[model samples]
Target: MVKKRIAKILSFRYTMMAAILILLAGGLVLLPKYQESEGIPAEQLLSNIISLERYVSTDQISDKLISQDPSFILIDVRSEERYNSYTLPNAINIPLKKLLDKEFESYLNQDQYDVVFFSDDNFYADQAWAICNRLEYKNLHVLKGGINKWFTTIINPKKPNENMSSKAFELYTTRKAASLFYGVVYPDQTKTKSVIKKAPRKIITVKKKKKMPVEGGC
Candidate 1:
């Protein structure tokens, strides 16, 4: 009888211990690793930036333009002067400082256009990305290498060396076709526009290291 009573007590203790363990596990899982105090946390931003999905390449943008992809929405985040000097066809100007304008909320917050942001050197576009990301906006992207890359590759494409791989030749050909379609003559080196390139996956400059780390339709 004593042994039976002891066994019952032992079983009850084991059950209680198991319940406690499960509750602890659940609490830890529910806990947020880092709080999003103001803007997006560095961890989340770093992860998203590293993921190349957040960036669109010049080739991709060009193809979309040639196809007359109405779903694509290009936003030039440079000054009005630069935007006026030369901007993508059908692109809208939205300076970085004015990104949070209430009027733009619908364009950004809506799900219709595949919004792509570009600036001279990816600086302003990245800032815009961070803002839109904080707001949990969807279908937003930064133009990789921005307009500088577009000019170098599509505007006035340099001929690849004979020794270069066929892929290089093919890419240049595609760029040539895109230039013609866009009505841009090659070798327009005098032209300049605010642009940005997608950041490299990692930036190992001394104490910090960001590991290298987007989607589309129509």
Candidate 2:
């Protein structure tokens, strides 16, 4: 069945990610004294790494934005230049290089909001997640397929074929509305320029919290 094939693909992806984890661990070892400690055990880190629960789909993110859900935070892991050019509505720019910076620790190392990290593709975002997960950060998720998938699914969704199921059309309708909500301008027969309303970027004030030990084991 289709589901079985999907499961196999995911299995393969995770297997590859496990290998990447070894390389990441080796790379971290060569970093400065600040990153000397391997925060979590290998087994636990691998368990967390291979889990599919770490991803939030584009549709889910779009729904949260449309509904104005305050429970999640979108962190764009691209550079400042790329972030300024284009990013998801309300996404905060936190470059991959500065992810472990003291100033941004509260945002990533907290249990409050569901922090979602994304980049142009999964590469940078997954690296960010791996680094954080090793440090035992909680409630961290990567945007599935990153900004590229978001643009394809939410910004410029293709119309379903006539023979497609009703669910497909319903999804298309939702995506169309979401695209407008995120300020995607579509061509009109009248040819008048449509005013695009941009959402202001959010600022998070980091509150000092007592540091606690991370406890986990496989």
Candidate 3:
């Protein structure tokens, strides 16, 4: 009878232990969700988790170019060969492998520019982003969807959906209308208004003729 009573107590202890473990496991899973629900937006939380300086979408980049925002510096993180084939105009080519090199140290440390990174895929770009973040370089951002997304979205934007809001549809329509009107959908190649240089005036020094009255007297 004593052995049976001891067995019951042991079983109860094991059950309690299991319940405690299950609760811990559940808390572990729900902690993130609960934190998300409490206050901060998920994007901000993710940025903090990844230690990103900022996040930018392809459309935002496109619009920035269209608006001629001069503070942006676009960097292509693809291979040299891939960059040579084609890249966004004015984008400097710095391959992912060489981003950490001393030669690129200045490029990565710029405080005046909003550096945007892109690659054929997000993999290399994200790697570069992480490297820069680890180095504590501020004003860095990743071009969402990378080059592929750039091709699909900014280069050739598609209608979102049939049920998209009228305002959204009108915005898209305006974009299309502007494209047709300007004959240039992308501002990567748009030349800024040029300042005309004025020619310098030529200064002619005329030597005055000395009076010849003294020579005539001689």
Off by over 4 Å in 3: 1-53, 160-162, 174-218
Clash pairs for candidate 2: none
- For model 3, state the Cα shift of residue 53 in Å: 5.8
lDDT tens digits, residue span 1-218, model 3: 99999998997997899999999999888667655444345565467647544557776776787778899899999999999987876799999888988998788787998899998867788878877866668778888778887666555656769888887787676555444433445553333312222222222222222445557778
Q: Could you tell me how far off, in angstroms, the CA of residue 47 lies in candidate 1 after the best superposition?
A: 2.2
Give per-residue CA lDDT, model 1, range 31-71, as digits (tens): 87556366666788788877878888888999999899899
Give the range of the ten consecutive residues with the poorest summed lDDT in model 3: 195-204
Best by TM-score: 2
Clashes of 3: 0
The TM-scores of all predictions, comma-separated, are: 0.66, 0.69, 0.56
Q: What do the candidate models score in CA lDDT, each in turn?
A: 0.84, 0.88, 0.73
Clashing pairs in 3: none
| Candidate 1 lDDT (Cα, 0 to 1) | 0.84
* Stretches of model 2 off by over 4 angstroms after superposition: 1-37, 188-218
Which sequence of candidate numbers ranks them by lDDT, best first? 2, 1, 3
